[model samples]
Every structure is written in structure tokens, then in C-alpha cells.
Target: MVEHSNRKDSRAAEAHQSSCLDPFGTWKMSNAAHGFGYPSFVSYNGLEMVWAILFYVPRWLWKNWEAGKVSALRMDLNLGIISEVEKKLKKKLLIDYMYSNLKHHNFWAYRYFFCEFLSLINVGGQMVLLDRFFDGTFFTYGIEVMSFADRDQEDRIDPMIYVFPRMTKCTFHKFGTSGNIEKHDALCILPLNIVNEKIYIFIWFWLLIIGFLTFLVLVYRAAIIFSPYIRALVLRMRYRRVKRECIDMVIGKSYVGDWFLIYLMGQNIDSVIFKDVIHELAKKLGYRSRDIGET
Candidate 1:
């Protein structure tokens, strides 16, 4: 008798679950599993707007650098923490401010790296938001679409279609003339979801690409900071004409911040002129016994 009662209770629970999933199950507005994407659309649209502005900051920083006098970026006396220590050496504080915007190159480079990291975080946050919006289906969304082709068409349902259905059913209720209730089923063709489907599909793949690239940038910057050889190698690549000894000397004498500032200055100045600058910088810095690298 107890086993029979247990079975009955299990069945009741299943029925309740099914009914909860479909409040109007009797009228049968099927294909409601998507939960209509998101109950509220405001948050997801706001996240997309944030993603739009993500790349603009680094672009603006680079643009302002266009006006800097290339010759003023010279490392005449020393390197590192130019904002405070180098103020006495500044014949033209305004021009120095243009190029030596940060206290030191390491700080600028670190900030730049943080920007890359923030971009990665932004992508991850958006992906998580999308997963929550779509009820945990968005995480594997792109992978599922790619694998959709390999599966047998007989039983396979397109994830995209499942998540963003072109047609959905709605159950409507009304009162008849006899004061009795009547139910009606209606199919809705979501023309907007057709566009939405394409938009999110592109965003899914694009964000993956961007996230991967940003991660690589972070790794590359990390290597440059931790490994002196990498710093020297990158400097060599920047100006092949710059001497190997000079590159090693600069990398050894300077810390990550100083190295980074010089690196950015290299971008604005001509390579031949940059080679002379490095050569002169190394020659002058060699005479100083004080090691500011630790500083």
C-alpha cells in the first residue's frame, strides 16, 4: 500500500511540474521552453552598448599622441617616474606632458594591459549575461551551432531555432455569450527574432574572437614585463638597426615602466632616429653608477 502511494505521489509531482511549465497546458501553447529569451530586455541591450564603447578608449589615447613632438621624447638624463623626478629636467613641461603623459612607461603599459584585461572581462560578463538571459543555453551556443551540421537531421533540432523560434504559440482566453469561458490558441511569427537570431549569432562568434585576442595580448605583455630577454627581443624587432648590446643595456638598466615608455615613443618617432635615440640613451645611462631599475 505504501509503495502504491509513493508511485502516486511521484506521478503527481511530475504532473505539477508539467502544469507549471504550461499554465495553459489544456489549451496547449507549445514551444514555450525558450522562456521568451528574457523576461526583461533592458539589461542585455545595456551590456551590448557597453561592448560598443570597449575599443574606443585605446583609440582615443593613440589619437592624442599624434600631436607630440617626436624629438622631445628623448631620454637625455634618466628614465622612470618622469612625472615627478624629471620635472626639473623639463625645459618644455607642456611638450614633456604630451609624450611623457604617464609618470613612467611601465605605468602606461600596465594601464594599457589592464584595458586589455577589462575587455576580456567584458566579453566574459556579456557571455554570462547571455547564458542567464537564455536560461544557460548560451555558454555552449556557438559550439552547438557548429556541431549542428554533424548530427543526423532526422532527430536533430537547431539550437538557434530552439532558442529563437520563428513561430511561437500563445493561449488566449475569453468569455462566451453564455457566460462560459473559452480558450483560443494563436501562432505568432516573430519577425523581430529573425533579425535578433542573426545579431546574437554574430555577437557570439565575434566576442569569442575578441576575447581570445585580448587574452593573448595580456600574456604577451606579461612576458615582456617578466622576461628581460623578451623586452630586448621586442625592442630589436621594433628597430632592427638598434644594436643588440644597446637593446640589452636598455632592457637591463630600465624596469618595465621605463621600457614601456620608450616603446611607445618608438611608435611615434622614425626608426632611424629611434635607433640613434636608443644608442645615445644607452651610452649616457651606462656612465651613471646608480641603478634606478629597482626604483
Candidate 2:
């Protein structure tokens, strides 16, 4: 009697677990024959919704506000006060940070760097999410698809077919008129996988490209942080009229944060005014702009 009761309890526990995992019923997913689909889509859909609303959207808006807004620091400070600002730029004075939070006047250099870092994290996270959702096959999915052509025709089973089967069996349970249970079985065909396979393949390649580019962006950020040459090079690319000697001297004296502030200033102010500022800054730092009076 105890053995029978234990067997019944075991079956009840399994039923409860299955109901928790598949609340809508397993008949929608699989039957006794095969189990190709997973319940991961529920988590994946929730992830997309929560990640976008809580994570991506707020950062996107903040980044846009920070980058697209005007810089009063670029416009307000001129040669008249270049002497004062030059002192601040060269040394970490007590008052330098007082003006840091004024409207559109932030250096935002480290914020920009961290945004790039988040982008790397985002790409990496999506890869992991896909891998988890696809049952760990997503990492090598692209490779398997690419190499499928080289295999023997008979041996070449499309990876998409295994990942997303076109056909499966379903079983449904119901109550009969006599109070007994009724079972209904049917074979289901998923035409959607035809389009889904192609879509996921494209996403796989696109993620690779985005991941590579984000890594390069991080590398570039690090390069500018460590190398003054790269700092000057970036400034030169933005405003051509700033004399090379002035840039070299200015960057040589400027901290990475100050240099980054100047770099961000490039997009806001006029190039001619920008050139004049560089020249005056160089003069304040006791170096002359090389191309004197040259347009």
C-alpha cells in the first residue's frame, strides 16, 4: 500500500512540475514522439520587453541629450578668459569641477567611454541570450550552416531543420460525456519556421558585425586615453586649421579629461573660432601656433 501511494505521489509531483513549466499545456509544444521546442521564448520575449523599457530606452534618451545638445563651455569661454580656463585645464584646481554640471558644459569623456562599454556588453549579452534560448547551439549555428554545403548531399541535414522542425505531433486531453478522459492526437506543421530560419541566420551575421565594430570602438577609446598622438590626430581630423604645433603643445599639457573636453568641443564651435581658441590656448601655455595668419 505504501509503494502504490509513493508511486502516485511521484506522478502527482511530475504533473505539478510540468504544469509549472508549461502552464498552457505541453500539447502545444510536443507529444510522446519528439520535443523540439523549448519554453525559452517566454523568457526571451519578457527579456526584450524589460531590457528595452528599463535599460536601452533610458540610456538612449540620455545619450542623445548629452551628445546632441549645445556646449556652452565651447561657446562662452573665449580668448578674454582663455588664461583662466588654461590654468584650470592644466592643473586640477578646486574650482574646475564647480562648472562641470552647468548646462551643456560637462566633459562627459568618461561617460562616453562607459557608453561604449555598455554597447559591448549589450552585444555580448544578446549573443548569450540567443545561445541560451536556442539550447546552446546558437554559438556555432552560423558555422554549421556555412559548412553544410561542403558535406555529402545525403549527410547534409540543414541545421535549421534540427533547430526549428517544420512538423511535430500534438496531443490534447478532454473530458468525455461519460466522465472519462478523452485523448486527441494530431500532427502539426509550422510554416513560420521557413521565414524564421532565414531571419535568424541574418541576425547571427549582423550580431557578429556589431560585436566586432563595438570592440574596435572600445579599442579606439583606449588608444585616445593612453596616446597623446591619437588625441591630436582626432582633433586634427575634426578641425584642420588648428596648427599642428599648437595641438601638440596643448595636448601635451592637457589631462586626458581636458583633452576629451576639447575634442567634444570640436563638433559645437566654428572651425575658425576653434582654430583661434587653439592658437590662444597654445599662447597661454607659452607655445605659438605654427601657421600664423594662414587660412
Candidate 3:
């Protein structure tokens, strides 16, 4: 009996080990079985495109220009034979030279710095999304509205309480006659075995604070960058004071003017200009109109 019991216990231990090793029910399963996959491909690709366009292209052009200048200077300063030797050395040690010049290359340094900045933003956004996904999967509960009850048992009914799955917690709200809600109340039904809620609260608080600060920084940066364009738009709107139709015509003519008109439209500036620029344009084009407004 002792030998049989030992064999059974050993088998149970082996089974437990197997279960732990193959948590996804199959040994061939991938890491994606545990929810690892592409977080946000669209966002990642868009950021990469923007980075390539705004940072990479300019950096590449600047580097090429600098390389050309260096080559030209070397050609201009050196005699033909020595310059040929330098060219062969440059060809052989191109990588080494590039690395050595990296310290002095402002554009190259700025490109890497901008890439690091973008990486930080991308990682932060992905982390936030991942946290949200986890929170939604595990911590969130769905509510189903059932029958409402009058708690007061009087003509003036008390707020209806919405009890969660665990009956200890509920949310209540009373409707007033004036189509308004009043006397909102939420009751937390604490479990007999209490979990430390403070940590969760702290995490959410920290995320909120960090996210808000990041938002403010981005807004400030955007405002600074676009201030010149904004100023130009405001000036144009103030000075031009043409109808929306005329603005449209101007936009059709000039891309910069189009952006300014878009800004003006977003600002909801008064379009009630007495003078119609389109009408003037039409007249210039030898078209007759009875009313500028009709034109």
C-alpha cells in the first residue's frame, strides 16, 4: 500500500509540473497565447512615416550636402595625387570617418535625439494602451439595468439603487421633475477579505497626472511651433475680411492661403464682409454679375 501511494503521488506531481509548463494547453503555442501581439500597428506605422518625412529626409539631405562640401574642399586644397590617396583612404574608412564625425554633426545628433524622443512617446502610448487593455480585461465589470424600486415606500420615491454582482456595492440616483438628476449616491460593498485598493488608486492617480502633464507639454510645443502660421492667419483674416466664397477662391489659388482660410474657418471668424473678393475677381475675368452676393 505504501509503494502504491508513492507512485500515485509521483504521478500527481508530474501532472502538476506538466500543467504548469503547458499553461496554454499546448506546448506548441506561441507567446501570443498570453496576449502578446502587435499593440498598435497603425499608430506605429504612422509615427514612422512622419519621422521619416520630417526628420530622416532633412537629415539625409543635410548629411549629403556636408559630405559634398567636404569632398569639394579636399579636392580644392590638395594636389591631384595626394587628393587621390585621400579619396582611397576615405573610401576604405568611410564607416570610421562617419562615426568620428558624428560628434561634430549637429544634424546627425538632432536626428538621433528626435528619434529617441519619438521612441519615448511611442513606448508611453503603447504602455498606456496595454494598461487600459489589462484593466478592461480583469478589473472592469459590466452593469445590467434591472427593475427599479422605490426605496422610501412613499409618493416621493427614493433613488433606485443599482446593485453590482456583489450585492454589497450599489449606485443610486433620483430623477427630479425638471428633467434633472439629483441625489446621486454610490455605495462600496467591501469584501470580507479586503484587498489593498490604495495601490490601484495610486497607480491610476500617477497615470492621470503623468498623462495630463504630457498633454500640456505637447500643447505648449504645438502652440509655439504653429504660432507664426497662426499669427499670419489672424492677420490675413483681419485685413482681408472677404466672404467665404472669396476665401475659397483664394484657397484654390494658393496653398498657404488655403491653410490660413482653414484656420480662420476653425476660429469661426465673422464672414459677414461687405466686400466680396470673388465678385472682384469675376469682374476682372470679364464676367458681369448683378449682385456680388449672387456671385
Candidate 4:
């Protein structure tokens, strides 16, 4: 009787598996059979073409530029928090503000940095369709800082509470709102956890790292425009007062007259404009100029 019951259970399991493998199931058995074709996998290919033909393309093809800029800004903040010990308190405060005050806003800033670019690329069409379909919804959420109490600080500051999964890595969260807005939030952290959540987070963390590294490599590979060696050479010697006599010792004796002036000009432009920009951004953020240059 036990043997018969075991056979019946085996059959039931198989049936259940078959049901899960149904094409219309939320989770497909295998992606191999989907007939979306290579066009579906193409990045900005057909989509761009369609948008351009429809005259809906933004000037300078900058539709995604805003999203990309936000991602970069978030990355910069994450990198600063991960590396700068002094900024820990400030970072914790910001996170606390986010957690406590954030609600479902018009733009879902949570998912911008969390979701993998590849995943978004694959699901872009459906996402765009949803945005087009729903254009009047808005919500907000907050991610407040929850940390351990610190006795050393007079203000009783909390130790930064990082929700790390098994593997130390970054995480992204993506969501859309009823107001036809979408946003992404990316958090960079170390790989500590090894479980499912950690695995997923690490996947995105690795993806971002790989993407940044690839960009550097490509910049280096284009030797004519700029190479890594040239960049490093320029960076080391650019701000220094390089008299004409000492040019050959650094940056190669080859760049003598206009090129040297151009390099100096580049440095000057960066020094002046970037300082002003930093000052403005700091003012806007209600931070001091010292904060802009910190770490």
C-alpha cells in the first residue's frame, strides 16, 4: 500500500510540474521557446527607431539621459558613503530622512538603482506600455535610517544600519507610479550574505561594477582620443606648474607648445567651473562648500 501511495505521489508531482511549465504561467518553464526574436533583445534598436519615426524622440536623444544622470548621482552618493568614514553620520541621517518621510511619490525613486540594466532592457517595452497606459497616479515612500546607538558621540548618533544580504553587494529597487513617473534607486554595499537576497543584490552590484570597468577600458582603448596612460600622465602633471624646460621629463617631450597650453586650459576650466558647480550644488543641498570637497 505504501508503494502504491508513493507512485501516486510521484504522478501528482509530475502533474504539478507540468502545470507550472504552462506557457502562460507567471514563471515560464524555460525562456528558450519565447518567440520574441532577436529584435526583442536588441538595445534601443527598434525602440529608438520607432520613437524617432514617430517624432517622439527627445532632442539630442536624451530621453534616458535624465534617468542615467540620476543613476550616476546615486552611484556617487553610494560610493561616497561606502568610502568616507566621516560622512557616515550625514549619510545615515539622509537615509533616515528617506525611510521616515518617503512615501509612494510621483516618481518611484527606489527602483532606479536597484534593478539590473539587462532586466530593464529586456522588459522595457512592457514597462513603457504601462507608463503610457497609466498617466495620473502618484505615491511616495520613505526609507528612514535605523541604526545601533553610539555612546561615543554627544549627540547619541546611531551606527549605520545596513540591510546586507549574505553576499556583500549593491542592490537596486524599481517602481512606477500612477503619475506616469518612474525612478531607480541603487545602493552600493559590500558582499557579505550568500543567500537568495544577497545573490540577487550581488548580481546588480557586479553588473554596475562591470559596466563602469568596461567604460574605463573602452576609454583606454581609444588611444587617439585618450588612453589610460595619457590620462594618468595628464592627471599627475596637469595642476603642477610645468615650466617649458621641464616638459620632456613628464607627459612626453612631444607636446611642446599649443598642446601644453590646451592641457593647462583644460585644467583651469575644470578647476574654475567645477568649483563653482560644487559651490552651487552645495548651496542647493543646504550644505557648506567644505562638504562638497570632503572625501
For each of the candidates, give the backbone clash count. Answer: 2, 0, 0, 43
Give the clashing pairs for model 2. Answer: none
What lDDT is obtained when candidate 3 is compared to the true structure? Answer: 0.36
Candidate RMSDs in Å, in order, are 10.1, 9.8, 24.8, 25.9
lDDT of 2 by residue, 124-148 (tens): 8888987887767688789988997
Query: What would the TM-score be for candidate 1 when compared with the true structure?
Result: 0.65
Question: In candidate 4, what residue range of length 10 has the lowest lDDT sum?
Answer: 135-144
Best TM-score goes to which candidate? 2
Candidate 3, residues 93-144: lDDT per residue as tens digits? Answer: 4323322332254443334334445544643554455345432311121111
lDDT, candidate 1, 246-287, per-residue tens: 778777777787677678767755455556556656655563
* Cα deviation of 20, candidate 3, in Å: 10
Overall local distance difference test of candidate 4: 0.32
Error of 2 at 88 (Å): 21
lDDT by residue for model 4 (135-157), tens? 21100001112222433354332
Off by over 4 Å in 4: 1-194, 220-245, 248-295
Position 135, candidate 2: lDDT? 60
**lDDT of all predictions, in order shown?**
0.61, 0.62, 0.36, 0.32
